[model samples]
Target chain A: MSVNTTQKKHKFNVIDAVILVVICAVVAAAAFLLGSRNAQSEQNSVTLEYIVEFRTIRDEFVDNINVGVKLVDASKKYSLGDVVAVTSKTATFIGTDFTSGQLVYGDYPDHSDVQITVRSNAVINDSGRYVIDGGYEMSVGATVYARMPDYTGTGYCTQIKEIKD
Target chain B: MSEKNSAAKASGKKLRLNIIDFLIIVVILGAVAGIALRFGVVEKVVTKSSLSSAYVSFLIQDIQDESANYFVAGDSFYSQTHSAEFGVLQSNIQFLPAEAYINNEVGELLKVYKEDRIDVRGVFLCEGIFTDEGFLLNGTSYIAPGSTVHVLSSTIDVTLTVTEIDAVGAES
Candidate 1:
């Protein structure tokens, strides 16, 4: 019986070895495919970055508030109405049409600086200081803008640091 | 019989190193990595919206106050011939305060202007009542009475007085 078993073992040759190798190769290939598919999907989705800053003012200046924020228009040329609608914020001048503001642009050189006006109905005085409802509300929705000494145009939200009174 | 027992032991070891085991490990690792990336596990996420009304209102006041000062220095142009001109001039005043007040007043005035109901433009006039110190009682130099200024809020109206001009209390 022992001799017969030894002969049978030796008879199991390269064919069996080749089968095992093929199984290992197939498993490795499947693993690689599944992993890569997941990786590709993740990379395809775009991630947007935004920052919101809060400026706390005293009761005296609380009746109204204004803060410069960034808006990223990934889709199209956002209008004032589009910015207001997508941002979920109310504007007192909703009835009017506007493109952008926070800083007014000019028509031509030597002309004059035009004042761009953005309106909101959310203004209210709390005790005395004006408060922004949410930093995200200001930063998200559209492309961002800056409050600078020069012309108003596109800008990014670099930080969310507080503006001390 | 002894040889067959030894062969079975060798086969058991080989099973431990099979492709199935390796595949299971790879799948687990891929799933973990995918979840982390999709949910931004390592990144900070912030959601933005709009500013509150109170902040916007204060900003308007500041803008109105500023425009009141600028109007004093700017050329005296009426709402007719200078309507387009003021739009350009107002655009130049980018201070948040100036923007807010101009936006509010312009919209209101435009509504009236378009309707042709409001003819005599209401300008903000200030009367500075001052005293011994800078702003003492009855010593009105900051604002001149009857001088046209923008009315900010119901409680606050930009008044121009006969007193001397003192730029000390001007809010930045």
Candidate 2:
């Protein structure tokens, strides 16, 4: 009787061990799949910094211009209104001291230099350069426009300069 | 003699069971770690960079029916070229739209993600420097007060005059 009990206990122990191992294997597999998916999603998205310059055509004392802005590809289908994500760190303004009443006069004021740093995600080629939807390399002076979220009129006013990703 | 043999067998079984239990625990812990790593809960430490803050405002027009849902606080606004920029930093409507009041003095304060024309104000944090134009936040230039900012939206174009700018200190 003792031997029989011992043998039965051993059999139950084996079954429990098998079940535990199987569960662990399943869990590990699931985690691995989830991790792979997360990595792939990260790879599909790229963050890039774009250095933009905006010059004031006229001079007026303004406190600051705080609005949603974008750099669009003018020569491509993007002209129909497509935008990229400008990172908070890169979306900014630079130029004359507005607080002191410095104005941009003449053709373009010497202090009228407005440098905007914009960070966005674009389809980068294997060479790691930004390309439009048609896979055209974003060239220097490609007629890019600085568009704002203006609900009343045409928003494209400033052209981009010195774009460096 | 048979009783002693049986006792020995039982002890061996216990030992084996303990080993299996330990292995199971290890596997479980590993699985948990994997999940945490994937979700960024157990991120690796890296050097931190500096960030700056600025207060900004926008005069947005009436929202169209289709795009009304995208104007809520916390909703990210990207440029037409897929560049993520301003986020909806503030909205008058907190819990319910009916509960909020619109102040016309500061322009029509509208509920977030609602179809209305209103003036929205918020703050953004980014890397910038103090330049001749004003305080350069990110790459956009902030001019002095009274300057006209031509805002171009998909549906309409509007202009907003700069009112105020307060740049916070530089800290990591």
Best by lDDT: 2
Instruction: Fill in the DockQ of model 1.
Output: 0.03
Across B35-139, the per-residue lDDT of candidate 2 in tens digits comes to 776544543222234335555443333333344344455443433322324323445422222122332232333324343334433332323344432443344
TM-score of chain B of each: 0.20, 0.34
**Model 1 off-target regions past 4 Å?**
A1-165, B1-15, B42-172
Candidate 2 docking classification: incorrect
lDDT tens digits, residues B1-172, model 1?
7877777666653234445456567767877987777554533222223111110011122223324444332233222211211111122222321111123421221211222111121221122233221221112111121112233232323322111223334423
DockQ-derived CAPRI band for the predicted complex in model 1: incorrect
Q: Write the per-residue lDDT of candidate 2 for residues A66-159, one digit (tens) a residue.
A: 3334443422324222233321211212224345545322222212333445445445555765544324445445334443332111122233
**Candidate 2, backbone clash total:** 51
Per-residue lDDT, model 2, residue B99, is 20
Question: How large is the interface RMSD of candidate 1?
Answer: 20.5
